[model samples]
Target: MSRYDYRVRRKLFNRGQESSHKDFNSFERKYNQRHRIQRASRFLLILIALIVLIGIAVFAAKADNIKKKSAPLESEKELAHTKNPL
Candidate 1:
């Protein structure tokens, strides 16, 4: 006889009316539209992340190449200084 029983809630709301087929169809359409938008957003997010990662990798490779090109110049300068010894 507690006040939190299911029978009490059902009696108070009279909650046994089934929705019409048209109403159910509208709900399903809205649900499907929202699901498609969510899926597209997820795909776009992944694509953007991949692009950023590829850009970072390309930038890193360029930086490594620049460092490699500079290393020989620095060694040549050292060799010249040693030969002059002044």
Candidate 2:
């Protein structure tokens, strides 16, 4: 090829390389942003699940306490009735 044609081809090749590099940088930025958002959402979901599990545990403990409190009263009533000969 002539020197002029060689220079023109080199310039076009450089321009194409620059455009492709910019495209790659744009794609990388978007991919990183999407990955960050997904990580944050997963953390939030795990936090919410832990809160719900703690709430359920507390409720179950309270119910068990209520049952314990009522059990003695029921046993006393049974004992009192059984003591009398009918």
Candidate 3:
């Protein structure tokens, strides 16, 4: 009769608790685990790719320096050959 409904609240609070099965497949939990693994794998892949790219850039820079240092010596050798006329 009053605005309060104790019987209704109690029925809702304890209703069908025992009747529920323990299957608990719980779709959200599986999705969360799968999503976490996917994210971790993607991050790891990106990290490895960045490391490989950095290594390649370092090697390319070193190769350029080596070529630059050798080019001058090659030009000098060519000049020497021209002066010798042989």
Candidate 4:
């Protein structure tokens, strides 16, 4: 090939490589941004789920306590019967 033709071919090849590199960089940036958002959302979802579970556990514990308090023990019932004698 002639020297001029060789230089032109080299320039065209370099341009093609640069464009491809730029495209790849753009795609990588978009993918990374999407991945970061997904990760953040996943973390948030897990946190919310944990909070909900904790709330449910606390509510269950409170309900159990209420149920226990609403009923008199056998000893207390007997003591009441003795006191009233009715």
Candidate 5:
């Protein structure tokens, strides 16, 4: 074959290989982006659930404290005594 024809064939093969690589690279990038979004959404859901649980625990604790504080204190002698005859 002529030198010019050989050069043209070589350049064409290189371009085809490069295009295939580009196609796979773009596919990988899109897959990674979609996976990252899913991961982010899962993390957000977990974080929100943790926050809600913490809020519920805090509210229950506060309610318990308020109830205890509102109750009248017993006398020292009464505290030591039980509901039985001496």
Candidate 6:
């Protein structure tokens, strides 16, 4: 048989061969815990950034509204001054 055609055999684990399996399970658990913490922190960072952006947008809108309201009052004052010659 050619080397390329030969299949490598996988070792079978018996009931007494549980050490490797337990080690792999512990490693997998630790890896999953670290991955979960990283994902949660990333999500929280994005949430806080979005909240800050929304707050800035709200403040900007309020400032624009204040400017608009003041403009009409100034125009009304000018009209009164011109009509009263003062």
Tell me the TM-score of each prediction against the true structure.
0.58, 0.52, 0.49, 0.53, 0.51, 0.53
Clashing pairs in 3: none
Alpha carbon lDDT of residue 79, candidate 2?
95
> Model 4 residue 29 lDDT?
93
lDDT of 1 by residue, 16-69 (tens): 766345487789999999999999999999999999999999999998778444
Clashes of each: 0, 0, 0, 0, 0, 0
lDDT of the candidates, in the order given:
0.82, 0.82, 0.80, 0.84, 0.78, 0.83
Q: Which of candidates 3 and 6 is the stronger one according to lDDT?
A: 6
lDDT of 5 by residue, 1-86 (tens): 65664343434456435555568778999999999999999999999999999999999999877844455457755765764478
Model 2 poorest 10 in a row by lDDT: 6-15
- What is candidate 2's lDDT per residue for 1-86, written digit by digit as tens? 65664343434456435554568778999999999999999999999999999999999999877844435577789998999899
Number of colliding residue pairs in model 4: 0
The candidate maximizing TM-score is 1
Q: Name the TM-score of candidate 2.
A: 0.52
lDDT of 4 at 27: 93
Tens-place lDDT digits, model 6, residues 1-86: 65687657686456565555568778999999999999999999999999999999999999877844435577898888889954
Give the Å shift of residue 32 in candidate 1.
Answer: 1.1
- Backbone clashes in model 1, listed as residue pairs: none
Worst 10 residues of 5 by lDDT: 6-15
- Which model, 2 or 3, shows the larger TM-score? 2
**Where is model 6 more than 4 Å wrong at Cα?**
1-22, 68-86
What RMSD, rounded to one decimal, does every model reach? Answer: 5.5, 11.4, 9.3, 11.9, 11.0, 7.5
In the range 25-85, model 3's lDDT, one tens digit per residue, is 6667887899999999999999999999999999999987784443557789888888995
Q: Candidate 4 on 1-86: residue-level lDDT in tens? A: 65664343434456435554568778999999999999999999999999999999999999877844568889999999899957
